[model samples]
Target: MAEDLVLDTAIRDWVLIPLSVVMVLIGVLRYFVSKLMRSSQSPDAKIIKEGQVIIRARNLRAGANFIPPKSFRARRAYFSNEENGLLFVPKGQAQNAQAQMFSDPNMAMDMMKKNLSMIIPQTLTFAWVNFFFSGFVAAKIPFPLTQRFRSMLQNGIDLSTVDVSYVSSRSWYFLNLFGLRGLFSLILGEENATDDTQRMMQMSGFGFDPSKSLGAEKDGLDIVQHEWALPKFEQRAEAVLKKLVS
Candidate 1:
């Protein structure tokens, strides 16, 4: 009887525990899959009655895929009274069918499937290794290290570089991925810069300073006014005019 009990206990520890772990792992995966599918099913657009303004999406496909709000950079008229006259136009061709790819559920699903195939196996391998030697992973990766990684993945760039340049008024139109405008747009509230200002800043990044680069005059306006012309030139002009009149 004692020998039988010892064998039973050893079998339970070696077999039962691992089996239970595998079952729990399967259950967690199922739950996540269901949740992700449900999230993908929801409508991408929702209108709320926040105030008097009735907001409508101008571009449906662009609106669906995390596209930034419409900017008024291009509509800038040479002589316009309106503030948004010198508006910024966001970059990229909104007319192209490819631009609307992200809005399609099938495309998003396909992309996600491909991404998961690339990520899941590696993540599971890491998790299994970590489970076998728990303290080793935790000790090697401190809280601060993980925090920095998360911050970078989410924010991408630091706020310290924001004030480095005076963004231009027009560059805000091309504020997509080509320009750092897309990254800066992720910041909230007051952190966001106007299209013109951001464009100026972008120009500044290219070693262009509109404020100081003007060559003494612009558009026929002499920046440096030479007050009180030479006395000789003034006398000569006056004498010539008097002789002509006489």
Candidate 2:
């Protein structure tokens, strides 16, 4: 068995502390960069108009049952009419099918700019730290971990006999990348786009999948799954009133 390797105070002060600070500063920097770039990149007007139409249609449908039949019918016609519906246009004026490849290019561009802001800072920071700070055991976890985690936890350190609980400088960079997002959020307001954590989470299974969202939305809109309420509501109200009277 190897001797217990103790971390020095200097290593903790220099490597561990600076790495965490750099992570925070970089996160702040990335947030500002994303905001600046996004401000310069105005969204396509057509796309905004389409988004507004979809949202308005969704809202109209959601509240349709609450309104009078005439109002509902008018709105329905506005949505489903073959002549002049918001959902449809004359075939001669219709957009080319190929142009709808990505239903929202603005979203795609936003994703790209946000990603570039995050990736560049992260890559440059990781490379800088790893080059300068490799081969140092920064700290140790209180809990014991298995051999499977050895490479992941102790990335830069190459001690075959060392315990897996010991964390290396290089591994700290990655751990910090996901961890400091909360700190970034606390310091920067919610609207600030500095933290990539949400984007990263979206990349995970729970977040937005462009392939699934628009197609699923279109499919959902087609079916609506809502039985038109006004058609049978009068009969339901009369039946309830008769029961109450009896």
Candidate 3:
């Protein structure tokens, strides 16, 4: 009996206890390491209300290129958020009316997803670029990466700006990876890839959903009919861009 008890105790402490402790330690390490890694890339930073500060500025390169040594592209004025003390842009639907016209639910969903596919990768590219060269800290970066990307949902006509919210840090990080690859397809003019991206933007939370509006309510934003023209939106966006830049 004594020998058996000793053996059992030995197994409990040496094997079970050690293993359990190691696993717990690993879990903790992973949690922190994940957060550290996430912070390095993009931490879903929050956005402050507009008109709450004096002014802020962000330097945006004309074209997207992550490689710094080769990045001779001219830097342009990336907008800034004074309230949040971060540089970012307010992304919103470029044309709500045009997106509403698709009577086919599948088609609308498909188109929204495609636009989201575009925005997501563009966002990821921006985040990855900021991670290395933006003079931001590795773990303690000051600017909000997620905040800016989330706002881009509005840039697509199918997507409502309100739906853009904080996703888990892990989700945000991986989303960027997938997004980058997807964006490459759009940039290269791959027809299938571009279509896939458009479809992605239209699919509910993954894209835009008229049933669920977000920022519009809070801002008392005017809602045009779902069947509005797309070109008009493009023109409006151009005008807005000019005003913002000027």
Candidate 4:
């Protein structure tokens, strides 16, 4: 059995406290910088209308069973009609819309701004941690961890004997990088650009595609089998009333 390593009190005061404070401050700074750099382009009217249509279609699908069958059919047809439905965009039009989006200089510039905001601070912070606190054990978690967590928590150190709970300076920086989202939300409100996790996800091809979303909503509306539930609800209500009366 390996004995627990005794960390210095100064490590907590200097390494741990400063790293956390710097990370929080960087997040706040990044949020403000991104906000200032963001473009103030007004959304296209056509796109807004399409989004609203998709929402209306989704609501219709969710409550289809509650509405009369004829009404449901009419609503579904309005969205998913093969000939001229609101959701049925021509292949050419979809392609052109996507092409237009990619062709816009403002869109490209906005993407570049977002990338800069995410990357510049991250590079600086990582460099700062590596330069100042490389290979130093910053702090240990209060709970035990398995060997599986050793690689994740002990990034800068290369010791097989070290316990998995011991967090190195570099690893602590990363942990705070991804884990401070909730704190940022508390400080900056929801959907703030301070979260690096979202930026990472966006970089990995998870960004929204309006054409794909609209197509998916149209398909969802098409597959829903509407059935009226009013009669069944009425029967249940009558039975409950009789039970109460008796």
Candidate 5:
């Protein structure tokens, strides 16, 4: 077991304060650069059509019970047709365009620009922090951390005498990288790419799930179990009126 050691105040003044300032500066820089990168890419027609097709199918299914029987049948027939339907039509919507859209040179370039923006800024930030501030037992967390987190939270410092809780300067920079997301959002509007956390989450299989496949959208619409809801609404309204009179 390591003995309790008191951390110096100079570490906070020289190390902690400057590291925090750098993190904020880097986030602000990332925001403007991301805006420039996004401004160049226009919405692709194929991608838009794909989303429209799926949305229309979902809408028709959900609102089917609410709409009149005649109107519902007409809408269903239009979407269910193999030749002209949004879900079934040939090369007419986003599903058909997915291959082309993904393969398009424009899309490839936009993705590259996005990756570059995320990679370059973070790489530089970490590199700058490591080069300038390495091997200093700067600060410790208020909360207890596990032994597993020892290497991660105290990167450069290998002193067995210090507890795992006492983090090095290198770890402090990363701690800010993930921890200051809320502050960054307040500084750069919530929509702006301040930390790229949301983007990374989306890219890392969290945004779109291939397992929840929409390949069966057409089949679902064709075999939908819908009941008339208007007639039931009329009966309820009459019941309320009769009670009010009584």
Candidate 6:
């Protein structure tokens, strides 16, 4: 068994602590910068109505059992009616809308802003860590890890003898980069733009698809088995009252 290496206390104070603090500060800064850069374009009235329709459909599906049968059927028809329902878009229209959304200059500009916000800080931070804190073992994990983790935990270090549990300075920075999401969420709100993983996912084409979302909501509303529970509740209340009287 390889002996545990005693890391210097200075490494923790100077490298690890400062690196964590810098990363956090950078994330907060990025959030504010992105917010400031965000365009205040007025949303299209049609888009707003479509979004509201989806919301109403979702609410109807969720609370269908609470409403009267006639009311439930009416609401479901308002959304999923084959002829003129709000959610029933003709097949090719949805594709055309998606294409138009992709071609919108404002959307392209907003995407560019988002990309710049995420990319600039990440590139700078990575460069800073590589230049100053390269090849230093900043910290070590308390629990033992297998050799498979060595490449992940000791990114800048090139030591075969070093324990896999020891984290290199560069690795520590990268870990803080991704792992501080919960911390950022706590500091900034849940919807803040400081989450790199989410931004990356969005960039990789996992972004919101309004047409698909509407279609899904429509399908969900269509399948809801609404059983009016108000009458059942009223009957139960009457039974309880009768029991009390008896």
Please list the Cα RMSD from the true structure of every candidate, rounded to 1 decimal place. Answer: 24.0, 6.4, 25.2, 4.1, 4.1, 3.1
> At residue 130, what lDDT does model 4 achieve?
97
Prediction 3 TM-score vs. true: 0.21
Predicted candidate 6 versus true structure: per-residue lDDT over 32-140, tens digit per residue: 9988998898887877888998888877888899999998898888888999888988887777666767777887787777889888999999999999999878998
lDDT of 2 by residue, 1-246 (tens): 556886789998899998898888887887887778874556556546666777777787677567776776777666766566666644443343324535656656767777787678878998999788999788888888899999899987878789888888898888898777677778998865643546545643324333233334344455554445566788999999999999
Q: Candidate 6: which pairs clash?
A: none
Q: After superposition, how far is residue 123 of candidate 3 from its true place, in Å?
A: 30
Q: How well is each residue in 196-237 modelled by candidate 3, as lDDT tens digits?
A: 434444544344432123233222211211221243666889
Question: How does model 1 score by TM-score?
Answer: 0.19
The prediction achieving the highest TM-score against the true structure is 6
The lDDT of each candidate is 0.32, 0.71, 0.35, 0.84, 0.75, 0.84
Error of 5 at 76 (Å): 0.8
Question: After superposing candidate 5, which stretches have Cα over 4 Å from the reference?
Answer: 91-99, 185-190, 194-215, 235-246
Model 2 clashing-pair count: 2
| Model 3: CA > 4 A from native | 1-7, 40-216, 219-246
Model 3: number of clashes?
22
Pitting candidate 4 against candidate 5, the one with the higher lDDT is 4
TM-scores of all candidate predictions against the true structure: 0.19, 0.72, 0.21, 0.76, 0.79, 0.83
Q: Candidate 5, residues 159-243: lDDT per residue as tens digits?
A: 7667888899999988898888888778787686744646656654424422122446778888887787787888899999999
Two-way lDDT contest, 3 vs 5, winner? 5
Q: How good is model 6 by TM-score?
A: 0.83
Candidate 3 positional error at 74, Å: 44
Q: What lDDT does candidate 4 reach at residue 26?
A: 94
